[model samples]
Target: MEDERLYAWGNPWFRWSVVSFVVLTVLSFLVGFVVLPSVQRDYTAGGIWASICRAAGLPANWGAGTATDKAGPLSTSVVLAPAMALPGSSDAVGRGATIALQQCSMCHGVQGMSEANAPNLAGQYPEVVIKQLEDYKHGHRIHSFMEALSSNLSDRDIADIAAYYDSVPKARTAPARYSESSAPALVRVGDPLRNIAPCIGCHGGTDHKLGAP
Candidate 1:
């Protein structure tokens, strides 16, 4: 009976099951202990993922994390100044209003509100607007129309325009359909499997990007 029991334990199915279990355990250990941590680290700003995105011709910083070091020299020189740097004087606002009417009102509304194609500029931070204009002018950020328009603008003109837009109050709209409580997981953590980072990580609130309002 003892011999029979030992033979049963050494059966082909039993042996295979043991081997399979050992292999699975090792694989799980390797994935959980080694692979996961490495992946997490790479998700940080200026990490492996950022490098890969740059190599693939994508924006390395999608408003989250530090920008890649490969940016132009102008980026370093463009100080993140306060929005209030350009005071909303009547003269400056008047000049900006004239410029906006002539060059911008077609896409952006007269009040800096958005149209079908363009974004609303009202209540935008002056610093953010200035940086974007500079980036457009220097070819650091690319938009055919904006580049052409900004190319001819002097720093004072840029500041005036930014101030005018920043001074405008944003119009209130209906609340978004998806509340934070309804989409907590998607809003906060995001889906790692799909490579989607958290929306709030870059847009607003905590962990917002540099130069973002």
Candidate 2:
């Protein structure tokens, strides 16, 4: 009995069950990949192989060769370098301050902290500032004032502005102290099934996402 148990393939019942399982699996695959997909109106042009690939939910180009569709709009082109995150030299900061005072202080505030509708820039990651400024300069980001002002700025000038803003401290805010029951559903627990992540996951908690302000 022990030898027979160890050599289960020799048993008629076990062998037949294995064969039955394989046959059923092959039949199911044929039905799903061939029969069902072949009859579908969508797969009529592509034939059997395309039908199989479609039924398996393969990418459109996988069965139809390479895609020649035109690409979509281009996004921001700023690449955050390691040096951008590092604190700037005193001279750079001074130059940036001069530029900011002359050009940016009115909207962004003297210390990069905003008191109005404009966004606060104090203590923001240098990369974020660099990216935004670059975007504005290149016309990737559009705003009447920003596009006009950024168009006149050179690369060095943009770097200096970021350095200046980096030198300023951000305004302090009190910490949140919400009970589990009292906290907003979206804040405490995002709807993951729908692909929405919790705010803290990207914004400002333990998991601080890079380049997220």
Candidate 3:
């Protein structure tokens, strides 16, 4: 008689326990990626999260790379100078362009072409912009000047910075028209990169991602 009573209680407890476990699991997933604050905001945000998930032996979400995050940077007008040769005829009008020069060019390069190690800031999508700034602020992007430069910038400032650079045109790489007659062009490929490897091949364009802009 006692065993029969215990079995009935165990059946109800097991069912309720299973339901609670499923609910908690769903809640945890929502908090981690969707409804929670841990969502990252960059091209690599998904990668970073996946790395974390894999470490814990979980399957990663496949739809990560393309989820553009454009939540943080508020739209605000920032002054900017002319982009070197953006397709458009003019740079941002008024003090905004000048302010961009004053605040940004020290490292990002002149019109986004500086010799510094920093990545060029022109023509990137706004989602990319917000991610980069967030990384800089949160210490994910490591650099000496990054903290100082990104620090104290308001949301509007971040948006303006992104907008200002996006307007700049690609840099000029072609030689002047006068050089067309006499200038010589060479297409020989370089030696293989520092590795014990096969001869590198080049059909067109530079081996490196480098070129005019």
Which ranking of candidates, highest TM-score first?
A: 2, 1, 3
Pick the TM-score winner. Answer: 2
Span of 10 residues, lowest total lDDT, candidate 1: 204-213
> Candidate 1 on 83-197: residue-level lDDT in tens?
5465678888888878878887787778876544566677777787788888888887768998999899999888888888878886665433446677677677788999998
Q: Please, what is the whole-model Cα lDDT of each candidate in the order they appear? A: 0.70, 0.79, 0.53
**Candidate 3 structure quality by residue, lDDT tens digits, 89-207:** 23432233465687778866757655655556555444456556666766666666777778877765665666666676645444323232443233232334643322122122221
Total clashes in model 3, counting residue pairs 3 or more apart in sequence or in different chains: 7
TM-score, one value per model: 0.52, 0.60, 0.37
Worst 10 residues of 2 by lDDT: 203-212
Residue 78 accuracy (lDDT) in model 2: 88
Reference-based lDDT, residue 161, model 2: 90
